[model samples]
Target chain A: EADIYQTPRYLVIGTGKKITLECSQTMGHDKMYWYQQDPGMELHLIHYSYGVNSTEKGDLSSESTVSRIRTEHFPLTLESARPSHTSQYLCASSDFYEQYFGPGTRLTVT
Target chain B: AQSVAQPEDQVNVAEGNPLTVKCTYSVSGNPYLFWYVQYPNRGLQFLLKYITGDNLVKGSYGFEAEFNKSQTSFHLKKPSALVSDSALYFCAVRDGEVVNFNKFYFGSGTKLNVKP
Candidate 1:
């Protein structure tokens, strides 16, 4: 079955530490997205990609950057983590309209 | 820009009772709307979508939504709520001519509580 996956379900890191969140999809979708969400709040789009070698920032400005080197993979990296960056990160993939989401990664920056 | 709005911050319903969560949207052209549910500490799961043709769309977990063009609303509903249905719900919209679907904009979710 086609699915999206995210690694490191939970992460606790100190401020200024650099970290990367991994996301992959076996669905072969060309468009991928990354979103930040707080409990019971609106999810903010932080990054998106049209396809391999193409990436763009989403509506919300993010301190993290993303790279789409392969069609199945997209990774987000924070140069220097901060306490404020602590939030749930979700990875999603879509072919046209509806999106499929991964389990998500909960990051806590101390 | 296309946008989605969920008016109620929270909705409470007794188990086996009907449930409704309101959603509204704004867009420039034709709109494609969707609903998703999130369980605690989990990712958003697609419940249903309204692309065209029908005013009412049925989805997973016995949930349904009505697309009211005049109202620009797509409210989620279930004939009988279940305790397991308690979760956060979000409504999203994509703006474009029917053929040109693109990025989506989401609403701030609504929390649903179904108690016995």
Candidate 2:
């Protein structure tokens, strides 16, 4: 049972609205990642953090920005949401090899 | 560049029969392979991993994966399939030799359907 949690398991917002997805883990892992996934599709890494104050962009280009001010918390914020931004956002923390994932946030931009 | 591939988009099996999900990977250095399962609308759950020790690694829910260096494959297997086992499966690989070794490449998911 991983202690990772993501808020707003499902979110529906109008286009152009600003929104933030919160991710937290109690395991004190140094490595955290944010991935975007379409329904039943391949995962696209969007953002990751090596540790507090260390954030890096992943392979896929994303409009979202992430911050790692605290080791256990890594939140992603979109300045202006769009219909193209509709997808599931997954947060995970890794301990060397294995990654533990949160429940994920499903976002819909109408 | 490091990458993971799951050739099959979906696999169907009968209950009580065996099941196999194919995975292949390409990496510059030693490959760290892993398998994860995801139920509908849920996040991925780690199934098993191939680090270094054994070619055959057993994981939760009676799942196992065999790592073949010659084939550059780490395929997930289960002796007996269950209806409850139906889900989306993902294969991931991390290159040990990369400067940013923390990054992992994930394969397109394979949907498993177990018919009773």
RMSD of 2: 0.7
How many steric clashes between backbone atoms does each model show? 0, 0
lDDT of 1 by residue, B1-106 (tens): 6778898999999999999999999988988899999998889999999999989999998999999999999999999999999999999998675533657889
lDDT for model 2, please: 0.96
Per lDDT, the best of the predicted structures is: 2
Residues B1-100, candidate 2, lDDT per residue (tens digit)?
A: 7889899999999999999999999998889999999998999999989999889999999999999999999999999999999999999998678587
Tell me the tens digit of each residue's lDDT in model 1 across A68-95: 9999999999999999999999999997
Residue runs of model 2 more than 4 Å from their true location after superposition: none
What are the clashing pairs of model 1? none
Error of 2 at A69 (Å): 0.3
lDDT of 2 at A33: 99
Q: Which candidate ranks first by TM-score, i.e. highest?
A: 2
